[model samples]
Target: MWRRFTTVVGRVIPGAGSRCRKRGWVTPVTVVILGLSFLWTGTLADSNTPRQSVLRVLAWPGYADDDWVQAFEKRFHAKVEVTIVDSDEALWAQMHSAVPPPFDVLAANTAEIARYAQAGMLSPLDLTKIPNRRWQQPFFQRLSDIRGLVNAGHAYAIPFTWSSMGLIYDRKQFAVAPSSMRVMWDPRYRGKVLDFNSAQHNFSFAALALGYPDPFHLTPGQMRDVARELVNLRRNLLTYYTLPEEATALFVQHHAALMFGNYGTQQVEQLRKAGVDVGYVMPDEGALAWLDCWAITRNASNLDLAHQWLDYMQEPEIGKQLTQREGLANTMMPVPGGASDAGPKLVWLQLVENIGQREALWQRIESGDRLRTFPQ
Candidate 1:
């Protein structure tokens, strides 16, 4: 029998300083000068027509695979349609548009769950309807206890998958494993590193590696420092990547020595399956861990059916399938074989002070702009 899911509890408190502040961390003048650009305008394919008796899902790549979806549809006697997303910004745009949201159920991280809950785009889950949650680890059952799963006495999301963003390196390059995050910036790895293209995560990781006290809340001076740090990283990087598959192809073709693992072990699995000799490590600076959950939309046409999907996913067999096929850690059961969740210290994601500012700064960095280009 498989062990119970790991009950690692590190939920941050609400109304804490770490939550995104109402006033921007930096001066409004500074944000205005940066001229933030909101570029996520991609539309879902065939979202116009409403499917009859279908359970529409919007989730990340592996969450709604054909194998498990077919299983769920067969079990519930309902047709399943999925829309995949690469980022939280994209997920927000989809649900925010349709009142009875275009999709009934979707997966999102804690920070995003908080945002959607605040926007009133998500629905409170009826735990009584999801009895399978009894099989979930205690940490997950106490949804209100988690940092972002509950708001104003309502359960907004169900913890489903969890993993840490760590370093993935080429094993052939180093017989002994490296222990520090600095390897990504080492001079020896010049033009051999692949970095994620996201503004929020890159800035946070840079802050972590630089020993910043709080990676999520950077002062203007710290922001400038992180910006310069990323510019240096850009000089050494072969290219920045977004999707896991894209990273895999780049790693193989470019012979990348180091990469910031965004999809966590999922990326590691993909690379290994492609026959690449690579190793993953959580550096001394610690790794950022993201917990993604399944949530219902406020306008879901089939509320009961949506709850069934969440309940079914929490099953041991389905959770096992998630790990074996997608290379993702499932919250419904312990990591197979009594593996410990202990590793690099796990930094639970929190609301940033100013995501717009980070996005603006990131656009500049990606465009190859010098740090001096933006006004101080």
Candidate 2:
């Protein structure tokens, strides 16, 4: 369950064109479809004393691999059982709905944690039993720091891997390289662009185009303005959704121009090697970042083992390995120190529950009240 880091590269600012940034507040109905909260109620972790059996976990694709599972078993004399979830939101419904939540450990992200905490569906972390706790970077010192926008700061959650959200594009698409954000909406590139279907990413992209703050603090009007811009993006778009595998295929085989790339540089390298001329740009507007961490359920079956796993993950050796192998940029993968960014704590605001304050912004986008972009 470890990933690697290649190198640090630079980022560019993107563009906004035509009537994109000039419209009404997006309505809330569409939000319903995309706004399900993550509810993790499983018993992957059970027992306070050492156990001989395996621990069950509902995590993402990478965590379920055999080699990773075997390694943990060998180290602690306990086996690991894992399940793969389609989305963070899906994991949420499964945990909260079932009584005695079947899984003990749930792979979680920053935004999802805050919602779970608010809902009272989680348990506090006990650091005393976990041996791997000492290795964590200062970033995960407290749940609030790693979870950031997600409010379950203390008593719940431990950091695992983290990264920023930004643009991934085909390299051969442009000659001189369009580094600025403005190029994304160029009339010439119409119909060649592919956008992520996520509201957070979409609105964040628009907010950046408007010279708004990074991890934008959307006001009633600012958020509305962002929704207007994305709806208009419907006209010139080739693909208006988020699919990593599909994006890869579209870029290489179908000539798509761009899509939201999570994690970081690896996405760019993957496309380039697959015979697509792909690349990524961080953008001057900065971008939404995230940490996919591990958390214990309120009624975990194996409290001791879960705590042990939490500490194990913190060890620099284990954490670094996961980051490099999984292509996840945990809390330690940043600029070596407490490096600074230009705006509001990009570190702190990475995860946002845009459901409340940004409701109007999302509504207009869903109803197409201000949209006019891409192919109609």
Candidate 2 structure quality by residue, lDDT tens digits, 1-376: 2231222112111222122222232111111011111222554545675646546676754544455565667787776656555344446656765787777787777667767767776778765776465555655654443433334235577767755666776666767655556667777777777665455556666777778765445765776566666766765566533334445655555477766665444455457667776666666656556666788877777788877766766667666566555565655555334523313323333445465545455544544553444223
The best candidate in terms of TM-score:
1
Error of 1 at 228 (Å): 1.9
Residue-pair clashes per candidate, as listed? Answer: 2, 72
Against the true structure, candidate 2 has what lDDT?
0.57
Instruction: Indicate the residue-level lDDT of 257 in model 2.
Output: 75
RMSD after Cα superposition, model 2: 9.7
TM-score of 1: 0.82
lDDT of 1 by residue, 1-376 (tens): 1111212122222223242222221100010001011222456437675654677788887787666776776688777767666666557666765666777888989888888888888899999898888878777787876888889899989989988899999999877888888888889888888887777789899999999978989999999888888877765787776567767877887688899998999999999998999999888888887889999988888999999998988888878888998788888666432223334377777778788899888878776776677656
Give the CA lDDT, 0 to 100, for residue 366 in model 2. 46
| True lDDT of residue 262, candidate 2 | 52
Candidate 1's C-alpha lDDT? 0.76
Q: TM-score for every candidate vs. truth?
A: 0.82, 0.72
